[model samples]
Target: MPEPQQLEAYFALTEAVSLLQHQVEQQLRAEGGISTVQFQILMALNGAGQLTMTQLADGVVYSRSGLTYQAGLLEKAGLVTRGPSPEDERATLVAITPKGRDTVAKVLPGHIEVTRRLLYEAVPAADLRRLRDIMSRVRDHIREEPPRSAAPRRRRTS
Candidate 1:
């Protein structure tokens, strides 16, 4: 059985993350005219230079189709480009455009402000390090298997 403290911790973490995400997403949409998700996609591609669709989805914690839709928005805005991967005809690649980099540059200040206010200010310096360590371990454990929502369902035969 799971311990009570463990259960409490899990719920607390979920609540905190959900609340923080909601706040940040709203702030980004209102102040920056982009969703938090769009910012994440841009951030990943900007930092990595380029990534395949599957890689971008995994990096951004989104389903391939969901990534496609969000990438479409970015592309429509001229912030990103999606095209055939040079090395793989069967794969599509996503990359940040100069405008996308510019968008990140514009959005980063407000993003950092909200993030700092909601998260960094809430934790001590030492606790922030501990939080990062704990979250990294949790992220690794979750990535060890298929995502529950997007994973293919198993077949059963009697």
Candidate 2:
């Protein structure tokens, strides 16, 4: 078990993340008609141009089925497209559409604003850098394990 102070910090971090994610999701829905998960997919594709389904699942830290469902919604909205990967027949590729880019562009300003207003505004200027550094380190440490995509699927029971 973690020490008392460590547990306290963990709870505080998770609660803060939950609160922040809730507000971010609301903003994304209101401003872009997109869910937070959809936004994450778009943001990743916007930055990378395209990614394999497994890659996206790992990057977004979402389950494969969940990512597929969200991708389908994005495709229906003309925001993204899914195609079989040229490099790997077994893999599917996802790419952001022009509309997706536009949606991201539309929502980015508000995203930044909300992040600044709700998070940064409450933190001391001096602690901002420290907080970022600490979080980065923690993230790196946690990611030392294999990504979710690398895990084997369990057998289905009838």
Candidate 3:
């Protein structure tokens, strides 16, 4: 890839992910009656069985307070339960409810269909392994770095 194309590629990939998220968000809301963030929380909890409040927030890229608010909503909907961690009184553990599992089951077909339409169909099967390898490497590289905001800014001079 050329230098200029690399820049365009970065923006293109970002936009593609954003657009895919929007499409999935709509499907989740229409079919499962959940927001993208809620679906993300449920999805993570579903896979992990249970996670600490800190873990949940980190996995979903949400702040602790934000996760608390969303968790409250999920709890009110009877989709999840939050309780004190047995290992640590100060920590909260979140687990999915039966209703949350059912919601995931109901929404999975649409989710899969949209993912296929947006991604699987676009990439050739022969290159999928390579694509996955590249994506994983990129994710790891970025994940290892601190957020841009956490880095100090250089001094400005007139």
Candidate 4:
């Protein structure tokens, strides 16, 4: 078993992330009438203007097929449009409609406020800075490591 301190740290971090996700989901659901996943898709399209379906999936951490379904919903809602990619007819690109842009403008302020309340209001400024630096270091370290399957073999092959 992990040490008590390590377990506590792991649970605390998990809880923090869960709480943040819940708050965002509630706010978006109530105010914007959209699921968190849908909001994420809209936000990605709003910021990028237009992106391939694969790009949208990557930007929002969804599987490509999952993004395709969400994009269909958004298209039905008249918030987005997907068209054959000009650069690659084989790929589809998604873009936010004017209505989508308006929805995003309306929701973003509340989202920012909620985020600030959850993270900034709860921590000292110095702690927040330290947290940012630590997270960046962890991310960079993970990015630097080779994939598990690519690790060097321990024994000589025949």
What lDDT does the true structure give each of the candidates? Answer: 0.87, 0.95, 0.88, 0.85
TM-score of each model, in listed order:
0.89, 0.96, 0.85, 0.82
**Candidate no. 2 TM-score:** 0.96
Show the lowest summed lDDT stretch of 10 residues, model 4: 145-154
Give per-residue CA lDDT, model 2, range 6-40, as digits (tens). 99999999999999999999999999999999999
Ranking 1 against 4 by lDDT, winner: 1
Candidate 4 lDDT tens digits, 5-99: 99999899989989999999999878887888999989888888988887776557666557788899999989999999988988898999999
**Predicted structure with the largest TM-score when compared to the true one:** 2
In candidate 4, which residue ranges exceed 4 Å CA deviation?
139-158
Point out the higher-scoring one by TM-score: 1 or 4: 1
> What lDDT, from 0 to 1, does candidate 2 have?
0.95
Candidate 3 residue lDDT tens string, 56-109: 876777766688999999999999999999999988999999999998888989
lDDT of 1 by residue, 2-44 (tens): 9999999989989998999998888778766889889899999
Whole-model lDDT, model 4: 0.85
Question: Alpha-carbon error at 134 in model 3, in Å?
Answer: 1.4
Q: Model 3 Cα RMSD, Å? A: 4.9
